[model samples]
Target: METESVEYVKQTMEYSRKRAIRTKLVNFVINKIWKVPIFYSESRAEGISSVQSDTDFMFEADGIFTLSNEGQIGLKSDTSVVYVVMDTHEVHSGYTRIQIMEGDWNDLSEFASSGDGLRSLCKTFGNHNSKYLSNILVKQFWETRMKSVIPRQGLKNEISSHGPSTVIRYAADKDVVEVDTLICLRGEWPEVAKEWLERKRNFNWPTKELIEEIKAIGCNLVPIGHRLSHGKELELEWRISFSKAECLLIWSLNGTQTACIECMRLFFQVFISPKFPDLFSSYFIKTAMFWLIEETDSTFWQPLNILACLDRLLSKLITCVEEKCIQNFFIPKNNMLDAKAVESKELLDVLRIELTRHDVTGEEKWRMLIKEKLLQMDKNDIYYYHILINSLSVSRHFIYNSIRSSNIKDSKDMLMQGIQELKCCNDKDMFSDVCKQLQHELEAILSIVTFCESQSDSGTDRILSPNDTKWVEETLNKYTELSHSTGKLLLCTFYFYIERYQEALAITEDVQTRYTSQVVHYTFWNRSKTPRDDHYPQITPRPTLNETLKNYIALDVVLLPCLSRLFRATIQEKLYSRDALFIHPLFYAFFVRFHCFYRMQNAAECEAVLNKMQTFVAENMDVLKTTQDFNILHLGDSCHQLLKKHTESGNYFKKTIKSLLQKGEF
Candidate 1:
């Protein structure tokens, strides 16, 4: 039973490891788009998939430098640059006070010079003539600034402050994660941590090469002050954060070690936190793990001995609490524990009881805890589907944000790599099946876009050759095998583009008859609820995608003959909108149908199709009004104009079609 329980725990950690890989892959794409220094922190990035964990992100402040001394600010004397010199005198260990050295006050922004900002935070030392920036005041200002800026970006979450970070607590109705973002300043490696670099170790958990790499990465100054500081020191001191280094260290841990850390965190959160409230923090648990890993032999940290490891870690935690001192891993002089000695004793009592309940061995007690948590979680196919869905959702978000701004080729390559990695993670499950379908859809979209680009390059008389038509048919067949409505609609557009009116009209009529609410539209967003189908009953909420939505194609798949010229003109005129490039599948199907009728000189059929489209639009106006679903008004007006022309004069309608085709415009 012990071996089985430990194996189960290890298996659970594998799930989390795969999740972390997927998240990192998405983050790699996001980092490319933002082109800034951003770090994902805490549980999500650390391979902990606990539902209770909040997503933490840190953005390094731009144009800001933290130097060890004024001498280091040699050539950065430009007015646009802000520099602060770290002062370690009389400060707590693992903390420093930064003094503004050189920069225009305006560089800090208008708020910094205002009475409510830095002016209010200024304080003169008793004997010194200079003033230092107050960590507390900086944190407060950033919190206020973030709260104001976030709502402007359309995130109306409830924003509040926690330490140096701004917490965005999403409402229950919102399908978003709770996020904590911190604005930090990068600095050179702190002198206090030099000892950790050279510290003697019995077991080299983080090898010398790792230490050197971490040193090169340096540290960041968080806005929060040391908790143990008094008087003005409390407001002026900044804590030295090794968040980047800590992340690297956690990533270096083997499977067993990582699983042990997760279990320690879970134990603390589920068993200890509710009873002991603020006596200790999750950081204490992490810090203890670092020490435990360094002190124990590497061979002992294996899968079969996870329970033993957890027991040893628990013993370490109890020792720390009893001694009332949990040393910072990087700076040993800094005790992380507070002065709540009585509470510590009580917590130690609880830990002792839990570790040896009913005369149970410590390893047996830990095995029971691991088994209990695993039972509470949905450790089945559903969990794997959730990971796959989240990965696809993030990838979609990346593509949506970068489609217009970044290179299309890079976006496609990244998405392909992501899908491939996801397939490797779960080869025989629903996860792999969904990935395969998505891959096919992506290839079809790419083929259509490539064809459009070829047409644009070949210029005016560019008509589809026999080979091109055959390729289109093949792509459409493949896509249709996976998705009927979207694939057939795409084929219908291709037929209209090639002037095959009867073929296009037949496809539209067939699609209209078969279209239902069950047909999912390809869009930038993913649906929260899956379609109620008999397939994949094990994964209730599986994600589905119809097309690889890219900016290169107009209207999801339609690319006009003069698209390049028109796109350039649109960009120059600043008349480009995402709505112009994308339309709902239903709207697109009707739009193509209306054009087909206009081309064939069927006034009655055009009018009838226009009325049906308008009716559908009218019925969903309220819902459409809330979202950017389909620009029904825009498409409806275009169809109405075509209908008007068909009714006015057949000769003039024929002339209109000739003029549009001659101009190579849609």
Candidate 2:
């Protein structure tokens, strides 16, 4: 029975391992699109789907450098450089004070004074004394800046500051994923953690090579102080954040070791947290896991011994609570449990009782707890998957919107990397399929846009060569099995571009008849209210025709740079600022139908199609505006004028189409 229990735990851990792979692949794509360097927090990055873990992101601030000593200041002599020197003297363990060494202070100053240039970031003791920057002030500055910036980026959520990080709560109905972002300054490896490199470890968990890599990676100084610091120290001290190093170490851990840590975290969240809210935290559990992994033999972290490893971790936690000394993994002198000592008595007693039980009853109790935790994780898996898909979709949308002629190669390289990495995770077939579909679609769109740019630059006609038509046909056909309406509509656009009016008209009629509300025209402008139900309805849900249509069929027809010339003459300069508008797939279908009729000289059919489009726009105006980036109101007026002018003179319609075709505008 004990072996069976361990086997069950191993199965759960295997599930988590697969999830971790998927999470990393998705995050890799997301990170590539981010403009600044970012570090995803440990638990989420590691694919621990426990609800207790919040997704945290640390962004390194640009143009702000941190120096370990005055000697390095000479290395950065640029007048525009903003830098701070680390002052480690007389500070708490794992904490330092940063003295501003260069740059114009007035540039950052909101209140200008006669002596604004001489003003310090925080406070100065004397005229000759160095002005030390305050961690509190830095945090306040970032929080204020982020609050002002987040809304402009289209996130309407209220931003708040929590310690060193800014928190954004994305609330959908009752489900909320709180994302914490910390802005920090990168610096050389801290002198305080240098001893960790030389520390004796019997197992040598983090090899010398890994240690060297971490040392070379350096560290960050977050705007946070020690919890036990006094008033002045609290304001002045900056915490030396080993988040990057910690993430690297966590990433290097074996699957069982990672699972063991996750189990310990689950134990803390379920059994300990509710009763003793502030007694300890997941970080304490993580620190204990690091210490245990270093002390124990590497083979002890095998799948069969996962429960035992978890037990050992719980024992270590109890020891920490009892002694009130949980040391920081990198800087052992910094006792993580120091501030929580006052609240540890009851928690210590409870943990000691829990750990001392080694009998069958205790074993059975743990089994029950593990089972319950696994069940909870299973339930939350859908929600986590929803978040992952949404994140991937949003990242793709951002990448597509940001892509220009200059960055096309870089964007393509990034997407290709995502595709290759996603393909390597063979165990996650469904996830890989969905992710690959998205990647291929984006890659296709990018390739077509690039091709269009090249053709436009060469002053070629819009007509496709035999090879170009074959490639376009093959690409559109790939989507046929998955997204019928989207593929047909894009194919229709291709035919129209090549002046195949009969084929294009037939496709438009078919799409118009088959199009329904079920087709998902995804845009970042409006998020689906029921993301879980719409995208991830089942665990390992197979990609059905309808599911693919809902998730993968973005109707991203507007992204074709070749098609942009067709609408460029109609759209205003203000609308052109967005480069391309995401039109409603249905509206685009009818719009294509109107074009086909206009080209065929069927004025009655063109007028009928225009009326249908007008009705569609009128009925779904609010929805279209919310879900698409296009100016439907302006488009409607343009269509109305075109049709009215066509009725006034047949020569005007014929001449307009002729001029547009001759100029390769369509």
Lowest lDDT sum, 10 consecutive residues, model 1, at 546-555
- For model 1, state the Cα shift of residue 594 in Å: 12
Task: Give candidate 1's whole-model lDDT.
Answer: 0.61
Clashes of each: 0, 0
Q: Which residue pairs overlap in candidate 1's backbone? A: none
lDDT per residue for candidate 1 within 162-236, as digits (tens), equals 777887753111143457888777888888788998989999879989999999988998877776567887877
Give TM per candidate: 0.64, 0.68
lDDT of 2 by residue, 231-318 (tens): 8778888889887688678767877787677666766676667866766778787888899999999988886776677777777776
Candidate 1 residue spans exceeding 4 A from truth: 2-6, 9-13, 74-82, 102-126, 136-155, 169-175, 230-232, 339-361, 372-389, 402-666
The count of residue-pair clashes in candidate 1 stands at 0
TM-score of model number 1: 0.64
The number of the candidate with the highest TM-score is 2
